[model samples]
Target: MGQKIIRFSDLTGTHVENDDDLVRIVVRQHPDLEDGPVEIEALGGELTAVEELALDLVTIELHRPGADEPETVVLEAEAFDRLASATPMAEVLRGAKKVACPIPSQTAVPAGAKERVNYASLEHAGRPHKGRTTDAEKQLVRQHLDRINERLAAEGVRTIDLGNAEHVVRYGLEALARERGVTLG
Candidate 1:
């Protein structure tokens, strides 16, 4: 379970419930956020249901006061949302200052936006190759078999063994087998 980071700028009207321990004063000195130390005080400790979330700039840890717990509990995305309370999306956006715009790059995605193929990594990775396999696809796999095996191992998928007839047939790798002087079943 990966813990998602919550930045102060990404939230709106952050009033958490049962939040006697949420940090009241945060001095953010980041260049993009403000010019100097901005003392955000007197939030009155309430669990503001998270209206927005972003990562890797700054993080605010929400903890229940005096719970005899660890310093921080790393929670998954859904778990964080369930525990957090914030202003509604509309309320958060109402005349909010300083929306964090992503850098001008092909890989930059805005906050609250979904990235393609993340579902694959989060939901479908490590499973066997599924669906139909075209001849072109098989040839590509054959061309990059070594690199593919590396990626597969990184993703916790089993590497293809040339000696296994089932792997050759499943991946339509008979051409690769022939190149390796392997006799296919």
Candidate 2:
């Protein structure tokens, strides 16, 4: 006898008249509730509405059955618009932001954005011992540059191998760090 249900469209001070499953509730304007479902839960002698909404993300909140509250569920504008339009629920809610972009669009990761620099050749050659540089060491440096070029390919950027490509690696690292919005050690 404590259960209650309400449609998003019937949010206003409307009455269903004879539906026992339905609860009469005052509708509040919410950014998240602009175009979403409205569910009511009976607690003791009182009722509460659970609103599930999406903005950029999915969010849920509880509200007094009919009283307006300040808190709101905000979805990513893109997601909200898409959900509102695609679902029949959209016709139930009052307003919504324009469908600017599709929802669930994957965020693109720039090339070279990897936190670790994989210099397989240098790693295989092992760290230099003392100050004696051998031919193998020079080869290792070339290999490191090759790996860097491979990483740069995904970033859709150009790689410049200066007279000493090894030294230019610092510049490459800096550019990558800046593009990735991170600092390199």
Candidate 3:
């Protein structure tokens, strides 16, 4: 009555970026099995059609027992190559299946929203900073594209064609410095 050998210590590998045949593995579990119960498999193929890009390339951790943290399991690269060609890895981690990792929240932008400006740095700030292009810098780039078309007509958008004057002052000062979050430097 003895079969509790769960030794799968750190064995990392990564090569993902436009999928160069995919490869991303991260394992850890040398001596920490509290609620012990994990399993995974996908030996090389048949990952159910890129199951979300092979579960973004596995990452499992389990160390329960008065746990403060340690119970993560993220595998998809064909269930991490079927638990790396499982042979006796606790019968593919006891038929692994316990995934639920999604904690990312930080979205709050509505107070006069509009922050995302980098039109190639406002097209190099409408060029000509000592690189030649004067007439008082084309009338200060036409008064900064008429103050970004008066803040795009108070954010109603649709007014950026001062007759191609330096591409409408580099996209109307990059849409008035991204709707006013301003930081043209």
TM-score top scorer: 1
- Model 2, range 1-185, lDDT digits (tens) per residue? 69776533233444444455455554444434422345542232223324433224555443545332223465664565576566655563545455356446534445777442222244433231323233333434443545645555555545434433343353333343354465434
Write down the lDDT that model 1 would get. 0.52
lDDT of 3 by residue, 45-135 (tens): 3333666553356676676665433456666656665655637555666787866665554455558986633222323223323233323
Residue runs of model 1 more than 4 Å from their true location after superposition: 1-127
Candidate 3 lDDT score relative to the true structure: 0.44
lDDT of 1 by residue, 87-142 (tens): 55345547468746666785677789965332123233223553433333444566
Candidate 1 vs. true structure, TM-score: 0.30
Q: Candidate 2 at residue 184, lDDT?
A: 33
In Å, residue 7's CA in model 3 sits off its true spot by 53
Order of all candidates by lDDT, from best down to worst?
A: 1, 3, 2
Ranking by TM-score: 1, 3, 2
